[model samples]
Target: MLLFISYVILLLVDGTKTDETNTETDLALDKPASSSSHIIHPPQAVNDGNTGTTWGSNSCFAVQLADYDPWWQMDLQVKVKVTKVKVTARSECCPERLHDFSIDVYQEQPSNSAPKVCYFYSGSVSNPGETVTVTCSRPVTGRFVRISGKNKLNPEDVLQMCDVQVFGVAISTHFDSCASLVQYKQQHSTKTPLKTISEGIDNTAACAAACERSESCTGFSIRHLPATVCELLQGEISPSLQADVTWDSYVYQGCFSVCE
Candidate 1:
């Protein structure tokens, strides 16, 4: 009986290993990609399965300006159970810019909802053409994966990636969430704060729920810096809506009658 139990345990271990190997396919290969902004090298270059990073080789993708947060995103074309993400640093120069980057997964497009944090790398790349693999603490389910630069080294920094890859298994059934469909515009705020709640609301999700409950609420703004601030807004977006990096305004996309 002891020998039989050992054999069964061995079989189970082998089966688990085989299942993991089968699901290790790179889902982001040759997939469509978008960036906050790009200069010469387009965002598509990162997912072309090429790691070459010579100057002017077009083997990497780079953001246009040195913004506080510059991001590059990939559309898997289908929902995936993302296990890990890998990013190759540019070989030619400026590999340190990849430091303090984060990988985020979104059920909907990035503009549509806030993303869940998959992994955050706090260190800089040590070698040229070094590929950093960030394993998610747990598998994250999403169709869109984004990598954003946090600019820990400098106040403003551009993001340059030689190649980006996502490893996961695609799921057939779709994941649905009403809150995920809510649209948000970053660096934007309404002229007047319809209502401001400094306490109770801690995150964007909670702030959004407050707006949905209000009859006159058209949108809302939430900022997380000095403290969590939720501001409810009314009326349509017009010229009065000014650009403010401190706030991110969200509008209901009418996904459901209520978000909560």
Candidate 2:
């Protein structure tokens, strides 16, 4: 399995799609969860390798997001202002038991009596080659998040969660003056094309402006790059702010209105 060490939605343009193939930029997303490398307050449960409740499938999945819940979870941590959340089911992780799943957003940790649920997606894992993903409610907060499930494996020892992911860029950025933001990755590289060897911009506004002017850019990363260089990123829009909205209310709802 790919050691998605970072786990954050680093992003992949995926090209494009149609009826025969569905290729649209993944969609909007909320904040990302904290990776093991930077766990502030570790979850109540984790395994031997600090992967307690959140164990890396140790494999690559090819399923979609809508396929597995109560079986696998996707945690994220980022530095952007997010508005939506998307999860995909790959062929590798959370197989078989992923028919329908649920997501719960929590302002604070869900008590052991009822672990706070964030966003859940379910009902369809048959995307085959597509990225089985779904959205969440009004968007929640926090720089760190944990996605957990209850039914990822059956007695047969089948595993799900081969390839899981989250997408969404910061809505805006506030550069710290002539800083250059650099994009780093754990699973892959950034999607936005860089230019001039990744130079520094005057301020956050200038950074956003640089992104807006780029013909291929769908969005920009305000201060994602390293501090040594005030980088202005161009590509997908991302989120950096935080929220506490929950997806429990619409565990069984989805449609155009959900965009609200």
Residue-wise C-alpha lDDT for candidate 1, range 23-59, written one tens digit per residue: 5556788888998888788899998877687546788
- C-alpha RMSD values across all candidates: 19.0, 15.8
lDDT of 2: 0.33
Q: After superposition, how far is residue 44 of candidate 2 from its true place, in Å?
A: 22
**What TM-score does prediction 1 earn?**
0.57
Q: Model 2 Cα displacement at 25 (Å)?
A: 5.0
Q: What lDDT does candidate 2 reach at residue 89?
A: 42
Q: TM-score: which candidate is best?
A: 1
